[model samples]
Target: MEISEMNLFGREHIKVFKNRPKAITEILSDGVQQFGEKVAVATEEHELTYKELDDLSSIAAANLQQAGIEKGDRVAAVIGNRHEFPIMVFACSKIGAIMVPINVKLAMEEIEYILGHSKPKVIIVEQEFTKKVRQAAEASGSLEAGSRLFEIEGENTFSSLLEQNAELTEAAISEEDGAFILYTSGTTGRPKGAVLSHINVIHSVMNYKYVFQTDDTMKTLIAVPMFHVTGLVGQLLHVLYVGGTVYSMKRYQNEAYIERILKDQINFLFNVPTIFIMMSTSEKFQNHSFDFVKKVAFGGSPIYQQTFNMLKQAFPNAQLHNAYGSTETTSPATLMPVSYPEAKVTSVGRPVAVADIKIMDSEGNECEPGESGELYIKGPMVVKEYWDNPEANLSSFTDGYWHSGDLGIMDDEGYIYIRDRKKDMINRAGEKIFSIEVEDVLKSHPDVVEAAVIGIPDPVFGEKVKAFVVGPSLDPDDFSMLKEHCRKSLAKFKVPEEFEIIESLPRNASGKILKNTLKQVGGEKNA
Candidate 1:
């Protein structure tokens, strides 16, 4: 894995992997050449070997071409964690079309905005989501000009696209061409599409392979949504690059997931810490044998020490890794090393081989080693710019570095530790408090399953800390004990003045806790 420097898109000395697959489609072709008969992707109902994946995607691409999809056309998929998702990925890549994967859980307004913004030439949706997609398309006026719609399981289905008899013509696709337009969760404002080029995705997958030391023997389960970079680029594409097998889960269920792991002999696991928390606390998970698992990766949110300890116990033989990245970075900018000192457990490890990170203060000066600041990442994996928002592009990208909008600290050893999001950082009477620190401390309590901390408006202090906890029913005694637990670990001022118990935390499609949704909840004090 040699690296060479190239001046790409006005950025000088950008490092890229040499002699890699030039396009996303080439990944599948290489797999087909080496692991042709082996299953490339599978679900409960359907499976496709490398050869079938290549051949069927060719047919699908031909059908798309026949339906007038040409080079650089946008093909949006409002689908879920199905086999068809991966097929559509290759189909678009093969025909030089850009794939726009919309999170199925998004509201109609959000979906409409994405449809209108991206202006996809064709939208392939799942059966359950077709009506919503239709309404969104209509509202967005995307269907007025004849944007083709194909359902995954019904009439005018995507499966039929693979059966159509149309000659596939080769399109001139380049490594730098946009391969996917991934929309960020619109927590602060309207979602912006992060345009990931073919090289961005390929390099991300390569980084995972390099850091994880994974190979063709990998049997990974797609426990997360395929639309997400973690599942798509991190698990699916990474495994495919190594000529490994991928098992797709239509929907993630804890018990069913454990069964699938045992049934399929899944050896590699990648998911959010929340999923691992639930699985680690499950009785079924405790009874199962996970000795076959080689590596386990978790990210998207902070993990309490209790959860990390539980994961270690559950997957005794597996190496646990903490990853940190965003859609702008494709998937991983930083990955935990296989082994490190216990003191580095809280750190997100160093940046990937091709990634360069800078911690800059508010005044734009680079921060000292231990000082907290914004994390800016530049790498082959990082997307060059947002889809069509010039304002966002100008503000977000500076000299090829994508502003991560995340507050972090890099130690003298180069291990990066995420403090909080820049906007999510709480200023309490001029005292700074990172929500993740309080949330992690709260989750350390045995009775607390999960916790989220937010800054509530206050007259005295600029803002006061409030916590939302999802845990056992708390009596007066239990509440006091929980408060005591937090007081012992956190500063008195950092402890939540109010605590609310809820059934579960609201999350976006990516399994990130929606603090914005929690902020809208009335200030009713229960705990």
Candidate 2:
């Protein structure tokens, strides 16, 4: 089947199609119609097919109705990446209830902010987190006994709700209706919420199938957190669209991921570069034959060459795809072609089918080859706006295009090469510096384990480049050794003015650098 281009070649053209958005509910129903008995999800003890998933979510939907959840109302679920997540997400989508999947890793204060923002009618949680949920509820003054709490781990309690309501009410949702509010794991400022419409969800699902050539025979190993758009929209939602089975993991256990790939005969796998680095570096991942995994894709961060070398030696038969996307873009706008005889180890490829992406400089002017710039995406997949965040919406979207703050450059062939963000850049002594550029140059050194660069206050200079480095028992004040290494590679001003040797860099749960904290760790610096 031949495909028409999305209007990426023309200027100011947004593209067409997806007018009749079979809402998320309609998409799931279609999956059931085509592959009713095909397995849709599996855990250690429980398994379900398309038919079973539909029936189970229908029961949950009916229970939500009984609990007085109205259409277009927001609902919170305190759950992990287990099978329950997909079930609840689908149920909420079917009922036009905005699904707010709370990240289990956030602080109580962070969790409360989301609760206050959406003001969910009820909180669906498991027994494992009952105490935390109860505490949050009490603090929010939503401690009324009438409020519904659907506990998945409570056997008798959940069973009773299922028995009472086995039918689901169809939602009156338009293509423009909001389906989810995925809060960004913001490393710098407050977490901004991205509002995804029904059309955005459908658009991503269709794009996944179209770009990846997914089919019903495909089986996926989902290890990324379901709260993020990549796991929720790119992996789970796309699998449902293609009628594929899923082997779900609560967390990224290296052994479990390798075990599932070997034992379950999984075809496609989705995760971040961190997970891949862990897997490829682990000795256990080498013990198995992952020949069954046809497509192993990663996003969230740039992957290094060492890890790719390890994967090639371990699973040479598996094809590795580097994906570039984010929550606001509904996950994937670029489906990087698999690395060749040897992986390129860089270059995150061109835009996927159904996407229009370009790399623009700081002034919104298009960047030519070899020039780094911000990446912008415009298509059906881009979210309508941030949830009730007028300030963020005004700053993020420009003339129907979503400005992905990520910095990159497009080559002559249209392949994009990502650099550090413009905001993540540091200015020291009137000289510009990119943290990733400094970190990359530092990591290339034999002794360095990790490196993060930031600017610290200076009396003479406006700000000085300070590096927080992690290495195997090294001294930061060894200017003779460290400066020599930098002198061989980096420019004079880009080299760190001071260095602080630490065991590790402070990072958020999403594996992003907490540069603010690093900057605050300033005192009498050494170099």
Candidate 3:
């Protein structure tokens, strides 16, 4: 594979993968042609081979067309980790419909917001979330007179789509056509939909395939939500592109995850740091050998050094990688190269092959090495703009770069280090403090299982550091011990001024800590 420059999305001279699938539909066609009867995606109860996947998605596409879903129409799905979700993705792609995968874990109100915003012609949902989805559609006025709803297991169901006998018409879709509108995790404010085109997803999948050096033999367990870019594009689509197998879980549990990996001989593993941490610490995970796993990737939050060491011990033969990206970047902006040095584990590696990263200071000047600033990424993999939001498009994107809103520092070796989200950075009397740094230090303690840091209001310093620690049997003495532990590693001001021991931290479906929720908690505690 080579890199080449192309005029894309009305932009001149964007770097793109020279050899890649032209559209989302091409991924399935290539899989069918190459892998044929090989299993493409499977859940606990259902499995679909490459040939069956193609036929079923074609049938579903024809069914959608018969039901008034035309090209450029939005088809929203409230699907969990199941075979139907991926099937729907391909079905929408076949007809050039932009799929909107709404997070199943969201509350009714949140789902309503997404439904209202996307205004899909058809809504497909897993049976478990049908009631909520229907209520949301009704509340949001998305289920207009002509709109339709299909439950995964009901009278009007996803199965019916496969059963219908209709002609599957080939759609005229280009690499620049919209494929998906993934809603970002609304940790701060309302979630915005990042509209990804065919080229955006194709390049992202190619980046994963190229960087991991994966092939058709790759077997991945998709435990993350399919609504997210990590699970959908990074794992599922990436595997489909390489003609590999995908094993999906309805929900991730320690026992099920361990069992599936060992039973299926899963080789490629990509998940959040928290999941890896939980798996590494699980007693069940210790009794088995994970030598079969060849690649391990984690992100969504900073990885603690202790957790990294534990993962190394668990998967000795695995090439551990730290990846950093968001829905806006499709999935990966930076993926740690294979066989990365253990010392560089703290860094999130260099930018992906076609992507360029620049750290820009507050004044918009490019920062020098090791200088902290906002990370700006520009590439074909990056989405052109937020869906239908001109204001966000104007504010978040400049020139060809998307302002990531993430504070980062790139070392001389070109490795990127995420400090914190710009909103998460604390300005305590003009002394900058990144919550990830403090959280990483706190999680290094042997007893601490997880940690979240937020800025609390302070009249003198404007804001002060507050930490919520998760541990087993935490008490007053443990707090003192933890305070001393931080004192030795971090500066006095960087150390948390207030600490509260909680059982767990709140997180969104994407596995990112909800720091805004923490701020609310801090405010309530003070009140």
Name the best candidate (by lDDT). Answer: 3
**Distance from true location, Cα of 149 in model 2, Å:** 2.9
In the range 1-527, model 3's lDDT, one tens digit per residue, is 78999877666678898878789999999889999999999888899999999988999999999888999999999988888888899999999999999998889999999989988999998888888888999999987645699988886877888886888897999888999999998776788999999999999999998888889989999999988999999899999999999999989998889989999999999998889877876777989998888888998889778878888888888888899999999999999998777788888889998988999999989999999999999999999778888988889988788899999999998999999999999989999999999888888887888999999999899999998999887886777788899999999998888899888889888898888888999989976
Per lDDT, what order, best first? 3, 1, 2
Score each candidate by Cα lDDT.
Answer: 0.89, 0.75, 0.90
Query: Which residue pairs of candidate 1 clash?
Result: none
Which lDDT tens digits does candidate 2 get at residues 1-527?
33343432122455545343458887678889999998888866578888888887888888887778878888888888777787888888878899988888777677777777667887777678777776776666554534456677674355554564446777888777888988888676788888888877887887677667788888887777777788788788888888888777887788778877788888887776667756764577766677666777777776666555655566567777777887888888787764432434566767876677777876879878878888888887788888878899889877777888888778777777788767767777667777777777777776776778887777777777777878866885564587678878889888887788888777655556677677667643421
lDDT of the structure predicted as candidate 2? 0.75
lDDT of 1 by residue, 1-527 (tens): 89998876568888999978889988999999999999999987889999998988899999999999999899999988887888889999998999999999888889999999999999999999888899999999999977989998889888779895999996888778999999998888999999999999989998998898899999999978989988889998999999999998878999999889989989899989889878876788888788889999989998667777887888889998999999999999999989888777778889999999999999999999999999999988888789999999899987788899999999999999999999888899999999999998888777788889998888789788888888866544566677889899899989888777888999988899888888778343321
Pairs with backbone N, CA or C atoms under 3 Å apart (clashes), candidate 3: none
Candidate with top TM-score is: 3
Q: Which of the predicted structures, 1 or 2, would earn the higher TM-score when compared with the native? A: 1
